[model samples]
Target: MRRFLIIAGLSLAALFGLAAPSFATVSEPDDDPLIDPAPCVNAATDGDADNVIAVCTPLIDQEKTGKPERVKALLARAAAFDRKQQFDRALGDYDTALMLDATKPDGFNARGELRRRQGNRPGALADFAAAVKRDPQHQAARANYKSLALELERLGAQLAVKNKPSFDCKQAKRPVQKAICADPELADLDREIDAAHQAKLRHAAAGTVSRRALLRAQDAYLAERNAAFGRSTDELRAAMKARLRQLRGGKAD
Candidate 1:
């Protein structure tokens, strides 16, 4: 049963297109009091899982430890648990750390990755989004969010292949429109992008410059698509995904 559970967990990670956790540590200042004062800090950051857990557990248990110190220890121990595939324990610690300090992008990113590996796509998505919101420059969170969004889109497309395209095929005037209508996958993508765009508009404040910019950008994207002749299905899909990312407040490809 233990082996089976391990295999099941690994299989779920594969299905989500998630790689194993890289266990990367953010660098702290050499003379920083946080690092220098904490006995478990180095072991937590760089040691093996056993040592990390052993050293961090004490720090976490200390009632007098500062909130920041305790949160760091929790994250370290959580990462150790993650490496050991003790996902429940890892998630608990991550939750505690985040509760103590929701501003930590790394905590959210780590928890998001763990949730993704455990096949909790919605949870992963929420965590990743939170991480990015907390720190837009967080590369890991951005990458994870983009990848998961694309995967989710692909899954939705697969499930709704039988649905009609956003545009009418019977009145299709352009070759690109005709092509999109002919291919179920491309049609699904068209519908998805359209829905996503409309949703973004619905949420945008009226008369705002951001809303106007979005409209202009979307119009430009459409104009470019209409002008491009003989673009492949793959090209169209890529364009749609880029637009979707932009709509989701991510940097365009």
Candidate 2:
């Protein structure tokens, strides 16, 4: 499975002509301390969630700091809130920061990541797209947008499959098939694979050696996947992600 994933990744990279940037995980905001309120910045950036909230609250309430410095504090505090899973507060701060400085991509990217974690795919997609529009070279935003696009696509395919399945869910006897039917995430992956297979077939030229080889490879992959029922869902998801990258003609982000 690992070898197949590697091969799929290579195929995607070849198709795209360049390797896609890796997706960025959520992390603390970049620190830019103010000379006048250096302690507020330090507390917001380096302290724990509670300390960040306590210190930033005053700085925010006072409104004495410059807009740039205040935005930095807001972002740092927002990151701290996010770390503590205070999503509403974090989102509010991110909103304020963006409102204060609408030209920058940082706030949008940060909020998009937060929205993704909050299971708001549409909001995350919009925010990521906005970030990319503001700065096309922003790798984080691009990766986030691509990842969300793929997920939403898979979800749509899943819904379609649920309405008109290629396989009979009621009569699914195999462990792998049962697992796929029982888990929505896995079901979505299954639908994505089916869609990719059909797409490949539709695009393949008749009587072509390469097309024949590609079909064989796809069949082999499906067979192996079906037989590996004991594998964890995480493993299956990773494989499906690699396959999706191949189907999309782009390296994994």
Q: Which candidate is the best by TM-score?
A: 2
Error at 116, model 1, angstroms: 0.5
Q: Which ten residues in a row have the lowest lDDT in candidate 1?
A: 30-39
lDDT of the structure predicted as candidate 1: 0.85
lDDT of 2: 0.82
Off by over 4 Å in 2: 1-35, 44-47, 167-253
lDDT of 1 at 238: 79
- Cα error of candidate 1 at position 117, Å: 0.8
TM-scores, each model vs. reference? 0.51, 0.52
Candidate 1 clash pair list = none
Candidate No. with top lDDT: 1
| Residue-by-residue lDDT tens digits, candidate 1, 98-168 | 99999999999999999999899999999999999999999999999999999999989767655568888
